[model samples]
Target: MRKNIMNRLPVILPVPAPPPPAHRAEPVLDLAVPVFNEEADLEPSVRRLHAHLRETFPYPFRITVADNASTDATPLIAARLAAELPEVEWIRLAEKGRGRALRAAWSASSAPVVGYLDVDLSTGLTALLPLVAPLLSGHSDLAIGTRLAPGARVVRGPKREAVSRCYNVLLRCTLSVGFSDAQCGFKAVRRDAAARLLPLVRDTGWFFDTELLVIAERAGLRIHEVPVDWVDDPDSRVDLLPTALADLRGIARVGLALARGALPSGRPSRSYAVPVTVMALAHLLLYAALRPAAAAQAVNALSLMACWVLAQPVLGRPPLPAPPALPALAARLAVTAGSLALLRHAAPGAGLRAELAVLAAAHLSLALPVAVARSARGGRRCRTGSAAS
Candidate 1:
């Protein structure tokens, strides 16, 4: 019986001890300095960055020279630097956007913490460790060096200072973003957080930072801000006017998307039915009162503006972003104009009362959905704020 049992039993083979958790060494921090046509600045900036990290930073660090389609000797300098310094490496791209370069370098990094500052190193190197430490220690999902922070010391011309302040104010009014400085080039993020947020960030240009921060804030991520001593680089290559215009366009896109519930903040709870009805009635009454004294189009325009002004306070604490506002205004105007045209053609002898009634109905129809969507969004924000508190 024993012999038969042994013959039936299968031989137990030792499973080769699972390959000892492949001791893969990942850098603790990856600092990306993106450049475009910066042949003169590349070597000096990279070397200075390397020296600082080697002397002060107390972790495994790497300096990545992200060249954004520089049609100069920048690539050659970067290559030489990479070959010379074991801790430095170079990546070349066929595109020319700061955002594009950052996205590429950060996405490809195997490090736990990835960050970037402008090639000019406008932000002082002393702030580098603080910027990355929170992310590394898991205390925060992201960190930014803010020039506008209380303790920050900024040295720049009055024009640049004013522009920066105005831009931030615009962000607060338009997007309700809490971050003081959105355009600060010195910033860092954890790899895991970046993996989740990078895909949702659409702007591959100057507005990329603002879009990312706004989305992250809405998504309920903890952001750390470090007051940085930043000196404006006299040789800044940025074209302010073009960049500002692009940023405005970006704000519009992002704001509209947020208002329409296209992004991940979730649908708001409040209904706009009552508000819409009341506002529509008020708008119609206003149009009727003005019709006798003004042209149909002029009356419609005044009534529309009045409705917007009246609705603004009730909609929320701060006014809606320009993107959403512009569309709603456009829709109302289009409806009002179309209605006036059709009524004039169909009923050439239509009375003032009849015309006003028709125009009011048109305005109501267009404004109702917009009002409802915006009210609901406001409610969502309120709930979010309360919960956060």
Candidate 2:
């Protein structure tokens, strides 16, 4: 988040380009291939993708080679391809970051559905249609090729695989993200969605992908995931340790931003985090303090009930919500009452430690889902207000 949000805007304005001849159809999908120092792989990958799109893709498509400060022959090759292929174009940037390349090219694309693919082409090109179909049809705000989802066939080394899983798990636990994969290079977004989200995103490096998705999810945009066939690039140049460390820092930054409600969304800020945490500790202490006077189950029930009553006011929504089919007030009462009774009976003979664990688990399980639900619901009211500037 260190980068100025103002620096990220201004790219969305109309970009200069040579006007095509009359009767030349506008591309429905504009795919950006971000590259850096990949002279050898650039040509073949671009050609392969072009050929594949030409042979199989139903609608008109454009392939963009986004050269991000590559010192090698990559720029020359990209230029040649753009001049040779009618559907190919190239964008030059002085900086070196995948996110920079994407933002420059994606922000300038004329196509309604814009996406990016890694220059290595590790993901199967066969999944391209499925990836962008939703965005093209206006069914989803964004789509990503997921390697972790069911039916996804991926071939990669164990170490990278472990790191990928751990990174995603950290997102889930810390950020409450709904999407399965974050770093996958194969992703697409509607032009309007990108217009709204890019201004809010500050990371112009590896963290850009995650920051975009987090903002999208919090804004309650519909994100579509397509299980894909992926193969690891054997000669990939990315250094995992440095990248992983950077990603951790990015997560912490985004988490803090969300807590302060710095983002422009309807989702509640996590200002209650401190007070709520203190409340939990106090509840536990109250139970322990009363242990000498009452049974464990009685103390548990009383402490939990007191906390529930206090939460109504602490949450700032004094009146409970009204559910569509079920009464919100009744549902809340039933759930709270049922959870307490079960907590009382679930560990009747257990020691202090076990009972406390059960109490904490039930509370967490109940709370986490509500937090996630609120995040998702915020998307429906997602706004790209000028407040971000």
Give the TM-score comparing model 1 with the true structure, all chains together. 0.67
Clashes of 1: 0
**Tens digits of per-residue lDDT for model 1 on 1-389?**
63454344232211121232356245799988988889888888888999999899988787888877776777667777877777777787777888888898899888999999998889999999989888988999999999998999999999899999999986775567789999999999999989988999999889999999988887878899999999999989889989976886677567656654567763241223323334555566677778889888888888878876776544443244433666766777788889998999999999877886787568557656666777798799999999999
Q: lDDT by residue for model 2 over 51-89, one digit each (tens)?
A: 999999999889988888776777767777887788889
TM-score of candidate 2 to 2 decimals: 0.67
Instruction: Report how far off residue 339 is in candidate 1 (Å).
Output: 25
Hey, what RMSD does candidate 1 come out at? 16.5
lDDT of each: 0.78, 0.77
Local error of candidate 2 at residue 337 (angstroms): 38
Q: Pairs clashing in candidate 2?
A: 219-379, 220-379
**For candidate 1, what is the lDDT?**
0.78
Candidate 2, superposed: residue stretches over 4 Å from native: 1-21, 266-389
- Which residue pairs come into collision in candidate 1? none
